[model samples]
Target: MAEVSLQNLEKVYPNGFQAIYDLNLDIANGEFLVLVGPSGCGKSTALRMVAGLETITSGTLTIAGEPMNDVEPKDRNVAMVFQNYALYPHLDVARNIGFALRLSGMPKAEIETKVGEAARILELESLLHNKPAQLSGGQRQRVAMGRAIVRDPAVFLMDEPLSNLDAKLRVQMRAEIARLHRRLAATTLYVTHDQVEAMTMGDRVAVIRDGVLQQTDEPSALYDSPDNVFVAGFIGAPAMNLRRGHLRSVDGDWTIQLGHNRLPLADSVLTERPALAGYDGAELVVGIRPEAMEDASLSDNNAPRIVVDAELTEALGSDMLVHFYLDAAAVDTGDPDVLDDLEDAALMIARVDPRSPVRSGSRIELTVDTKRFHFFDPKTNLAIRS
Candidate 1:
């Protein structure tokens, strides 16, 4: 295992199009770091650059402690598993896994030992004799991974390796890959557009947009404390509910006015994010996660309640998601990939206990966890915090 570092990395195409800009990243030894973003965000380009598959127009890239800018892909000691699996269709699993070693002229006995070890680790021993066409999608993907593992590379690079599988298979493979990484403890850089996959599998996640890095941190930190509106909105599943609200500070008390409703801001919120005071008497964006809002009927007495007309309801076993319209403007969050049902600009969703009996066309009360509310500067689209 080896640490990888990218300092001020930049990539520009032959046609003068800049694909990446001043990217700096570090992956610790034996760490699994995931790069995630929408399509054309330069995540793939970044990975290729690290693998020596793409040239670095500017900046420095180091693998372990050696400068690798001029090194060839084969000498980088990095193995890449592509989205298409890239297995040899005519070759059996055993041959496919040991192909690299054979090409390097390793002894046949050594290749077999290495391939057998990888097959056992990936639970593909039963399918070793099967050809690429004979194996399942998951088995083929495991073979692709086995090919990389057989090399025993210092760093592993995977670009959307699970994208070809169905949702259920993808879920199952995700667990397998995570387990494999733990067993090998190899440094890995995985690329994906799915936030859920990034959240569940990564030791730390890096969010990129338009060829520039947005934020990188542990998944929980990215959710609990997003650096910007783009990261906050892009990293969550249901996504945080963002709306423009007018900030008001009246007689030492703070409140946000959204249309006809005036919700008090908890004093602790201001104490933690002292920058919130700067937005007094101005418009700022307010972000509330769906899980942070619940049925008022089931909430404690001190929770702040808001009355809204329920537009629709989606029951998902453990809880119900009640969609309602707020009297405020919706934020775009600057990511073109996010498409929602905010046609009229006031879509809000709340995750509530299913027993609360809230239904469409009925007026329902939702209690917000005010202390956990997020505030952002409208001008900069950045979170307001100390």
Candidate 2:
């Protein structure tokens, strides 16, 4: 296993299209790092650069403290698992897994031993003799992974490897891959557009947007304390609710004015966020997570509360997602990448208990965990309260 580091990495095409801009990141040895963003956000390009498949326009890339800018892909000692599971239809599973070793003229006995071990680990021992035509989609993907595992490379690069699988199989393979990482402890850099996969699979996640590195941190930290508006809205399931509101000082108390309602700020919120005190009478973007907003019955009165008419309700077995709109003008946090979606713009979802009796068009009181509220500067879109 080896640590991968990128210092001021950049990728500019001859046609003048810039795919990545000053991307600086470090993947620790044996760490599973995920690079996630929306489509065409330069995630795959970054991974390809690290794999030595794309030439760097500027900056340096180091693997295990060695400069690899001029290294060939084959000499980089990296294994890549592609999304399409590029397996040969004519080759059986055993031969497919040992193809790399075979090309290197490894002994037949050693090739068989390594292939057998990888097959057993992936639970494909029974299908070793079957060709790609005989295997299921999931099985073929496993074969691709088996091929990578046999190489024992310094780094593992997986580019949307689970995109072809069905939903159920995708979840299953996610767990399996996590287990494989724990067992092998291989340095891995996974690229995907799926935020859920980024959150659940990676030990650390780097969020990119418009070819720019926005934020990189652990899943929980990224979700809980996003560095900017784009990250705050992109990392969560229902995403964070962001609306434009003015902070006003009324009778020595700081309160937020939203439409016709005013919600008082908690003492803890002001105590922890001193910068918020300066924003009095200033417009700011307020972010509230679905989990942070609860039904009136589940609300603790000490926290800030907002009462709105439920626009829609979706009962997803595990929890209820209550969607509603506020009367206030929506904040233009300047993160076009996140707020560009109309569906996310018109509605704010609150995760509630399945047993909650809230329904569409009904007036429901929701509490915003004041301590968890995320404040962002309306102009810069950067989080004000860390």
Candidate 3:
């Protein structure tokens, strides 16, 4: 295992197209760090730069405390597992796993031993004689991993390795890979556009947008405390509900006016975010996670409530997602993936108990978890943090 460092790494194309800005990140030895963003966010470009597949226009690349800027990819001692499961169709699983050892001119018995170990680790021992065409998608993916394992690389670079599988298979492969990482304890840099995948697998996740780094933290931290409106809206499932609101002081208490309703802020909210004091009587962005609101009748929370007519309701077994229209303007997240939802600020979603009698066109009251509310500046879209 090795520590990977990228200091002010940059990538610029010949046509003057810059794909990555000054990205500074350090991956500790044996840590799993995931790079995540929407398509075309330059995440793949950044990963390619580290693998020496693309040139770094500036900055430094180091692995295990050694400069790797001018090192050849073959000499970098890093193994990559691609999304396509790049295995030779004609070769059996064992041969494909041992191919790298053969290339290095290792003894035949040693190559067989290494291949055997990799197969056992990947649970591909029974399929050693099978070709890629004969194996299932998940099995083929394991074979690809086995090939990487046999080499015992200092670092592993996986680029959406599970993306091509079916949804069920993807979920299974996700667990498999996570288990593999824990067992090997190899330093891994994984790139994916799937937020759930990143959250579930990465020890730390780095979110990027438009060639610039946005935030890097543990998955829960990124979700609970985002740095800006983009991250506030992008990190959560169903995304966060960001709407324009007026924050003002009413009788020494703070309240946010969202169109027709005013939700009082809890005292803890201000105590945690002292910076919000400066936004009193100002228009700012308010972010509410879907789970932050619940059916008032089913909730014991003493938080403020907002009444709205349910536009749609999705029964998702464990909980019901109630979609309603808030008479406020929705803030754009600056993410192309969610442009449709942000086009109108009126759309708001609340995750409520499945027993709640919320249906299309039905009136419902949602209890807002005011203390958990996220406030951001309207001008800069940055969170109001102390």
Candidate 4:
């Protein structure tokens, strides 16, 4: 395993389209870093650049402290698992996994030994003789992983490897991959559009948008304190509820006015984020996480409370997602996935206790953890925290 570093890496197509900007990242030895973003966000392009499959327009790429900008893909000492599995139909599982070793003229006995070890590691020993047509989608992807595992390269690169599988299989494979990474402890760079995968599997996640690097941090930190509106809205499952509101000071106290409703801001909020005081009388984006809101009837927490009519309700066993319409207009965070959601500008979602008896069109009182609320500049879209 080796450390990989991208120092101001860049990629531009022949058609004068820049696929990636000046992006810089460092993956420590044996660390699994995931580059994640939406469709056409240059995540795949960035991974390809690291794999040497795509040319770097500028900057430097180094593995194990050695520069590899001009190295060919085969000589880069990196193994890549593509999205398609890319296994030959005629070859059995063992042969397919050992094909790279065979190309390098490894003896048949040694090749068998390596293939056997990888097969055992992947639990594919029972299907060593089976062809691709005889294997399930998850098994086929395992074969693809086996092919890379036998190489024992300095680094591993995977590009949207779970996208081809069914939803259930994808979740299963995700767990398998996480376990594999823990056992192998290889320096791996994975690319995916799914935030769940990024949050669950990676030691750290790098979020990109429109060829520009947005934010890179651990999942919890990124969720708790996003640097900008884009990162705040992009990293969560239901995404953060972002709405435009005015911060006003009334009688020596600050309060956020969302359309017609007003919520008193605690003095501790200003004490923590002193910069927020400068936004008095200005419109800023307020981000409310769904999980931070709960059914006011269930608990007696000291959090602020609000009452709204539930527009929709989805029960997921563990929790109930109550969708309601607020008076404030939703803020556009420049995320394409949430564009359609903004059609109803006032829609907001809250995740409440499953035991709460709330249904669609029912008026429910929701409590919000106001101290945990995120505030962002309306013009710059950057978070306002000191």
Candidate 5:
């Protein structure tokens, strides 16, 4: 029901450790915005500042068109759901959900009605009498959400609320939370380290790194057209295959010298990124998504082809992942999660048809979709797009 804005937001401790720097963002009313980044990337710190839990070193925080930099956490009208359920073990679900209402000195009857409504919405009416210790992890999380819902806060702040659950439970809870958001239409700012969760949940996602904002865009835009090397490597499932390549313009045609192979660049590739023409005969970074490369045997299009020795193949029902090494140096995009040793630094994965008979140590041909290839400046690590 309210919009949140952070302009020039900054958080610096007395010890001179700056966790966030000159951050700026605008969350529209009834919009779900996710702040996603690696661990220790200051995402949680930014959220705490907006909730009035952390003092702003220098910046402006606004909610509902009113300044909130000096407002107390309780006065900000924001309900935060932490990773831990943080429910009282002795109190049953009903009392826990209505605790805030009771503290506000609301009538006992009114508290009961509000608690009942939240319980119905969260599908916890049957377990109203059960204590926190008796509920499952998912149930306990729902109790936390119900508690926040009864307050009818102006903004909902959730910090990795699904991290404690199992993978299956996490998936289930993701849908549940998204459904709840749709029904309530409350302004929400969700913070998480998981890229998949951010892509699936948020209307728009903000990627942060080293306490600086990277790119904010829809899931598809982030996946298809990353603004920089870091964003390109961080957003995908099997992170993008980025390697050093030399661009060459022979007569009127263009080609990329990728290690031992020479792949023809399509005309549309240059049409889409006219800036690539400037990098002729120069070294640049090349990025290819797993799906952009397919088994040459299965495809009929006359796309550019490359031969490689398949180091491994993983059969994943619908598609097979072929891991191979291109005879090129891999570009490090500063993602701590990518642990590529020297021997495996140039490893590339291709999502191909599962029916293909590609095995380890076998030579296979792959058709690369030249039009879908991404190019980045080697020095700046930025995408070469017009």
Candidate 6:
């Protein structure tokens, strides 16, 4: 296995459209790093650059301490699994898996041995004789993975390999891929637009936007301490609820003004975020994840709680998603890709237990985990605290 590193990587097309900008990242040997973002966010472009499928406009890419700017894709010793199962229609599963070895002129016995091992690992031993046309979508994807596995390349580049499968199969394949990574321990760079996949499959995730690198870190760290408004709003499942509010000192206590409501800031919050002092009299964006808020009836006195009017209610089996509105200005970060399908109505969703009897249009009390509240500067859109 080999480590991959990109330093100041950039990709500018002939038409003057910049696809990537000043991107720098390093994937350790045997590490699984996921590149995740919205569509047209330069994720796939960056992956292609590393795979030698696209040219690098201005940057250096190194694999195992050697520069690979002019190396051919095959000579780079990398295996790529595309979204579509690129299998030969005429070949059966066994022949398809061992096709690379066959082209390299390996003995038939060695090819069969390697193909058998790969099929056993992918649980495709029973379907080794089926053709691509006869296999299920999931089975076809496994065949594609088996083909890559038989190559035994130093690095594996997968671009949304699970997008074509159904939801249930996607989840199943997700676990299978994770298990396969553990068994092979090959350095991998996976690109996908799904945040859920990124969170679950990656040892580390890099979030990109508008052809720019926003943040790269552990999945939980990115969720708990986002570096900017874009990341804070993008990483979570229900997405973060951002509202414009003013920070002020009321009777020697720092509090945030949400329209007519004033929520006092905890002492720990002020101590951790010294930058918040500068916005004492100015507006800032306050972010809270849906899972961080709970029904007041189920909360203790030590937690920070807020009262709001519920606008809508969704009864998910395990939990309830409560939507509420406040009289704050709508949040618009100016990124059309991020804001395109967003709701015009400013709403907050609270994930509460199904046991809670809160209803729509009711004045409900919600508790905010004050320790987890995030503050972002409106001008820079970056988090006040690290």
Best by lDDT: 5
Model 6, residue pairs in steric clash: none
What is the lDDT of every predicted structure here? Answer: 0.92, 0.90, 0.91, 0.92, 0.93, 0.89
Those runs of model 1 whose alpha carbons end farther than 4 Å from true positions after fitting are 339-345
TM-score of 3: 0.97
The best-first sequence of candidates by lDDT reads 5, 4, 1, 3, 2, 6
> Listing every candidate in turn, what is its Cα RMSD in Å to the true structure after a full C-alpha superposition?
1.2, 1.5, 1.3, 1.1, 1.2, 1.6
TM-score of 2: 0.96
lDDT by residue for model 5 over 1-386, one digit each (tens)? 79999999999978999999899999999999999999999998999999888899998999999999999999999999999868999999999999888999999999999999999999999999999999999999999999899999999999999999999999999999999999999999999999999999999999999899999998999999999999998998888999999999999799999998898899988888889999999999999999999999999999999998899999999989999988877998877777446555578999999999999889999999988888999999999998
Error of 4 at 70 (Å): 0.4
TM-score of 6: 0.96
Q: Model 3: per-residue lDDT, tens digit, 1-386?
A: 79999999999999999999999989999999999999999988888888989999999999999999999998898998999878889999999888888999999999999999999989999999998899999999999999889889999999999999999999999999999999999999999999999999999999999999999999999999999998887787888999999999878899999998988889888899888888888999999999999999998978899889998999998989998988888888898888854434457889999999888889999899987788899999999977
- Candidate 5: residue 294 Cα off by (Å): 0.4
Give the C-alpha miss distance for residue 87 in model 6, angstroms.
Answer: 1.6
Clashes of each: 0, 0, 1, 0, 0, 0
Q: Scored by Cα lDDT, where does model 2 land?
A: 0.90
Query: Candidate 4 lDDT, tens digit per residue, 273-329?
Result: 999999999999999999989999997987777899999999999989998988898
lDDT of 1 by residue, 160-203 (tens): 99999999999999999999999999999999999999999999
The true-versus-predicted C-alpha distance at residue 124 of model 2, in Å, is 0.7
Q: How well does each candidate superpose onto the true structure, as a TM-score? A: 0.98, 0.96, 0.97, 0.98, 0.98, 0.96
Superpose all Cα atoms of candidate 6 onto the true structure and report the RMSD in Å to 1 decimal: 1.6
In model 6, which range of ten residues has the least summed lDDT?
336-345
Candidate 2 residue lDDT tens string, 67-87: 999999999999999998789
lDDT of 6 at 45: 93
lDDT of 5 at 154: 95
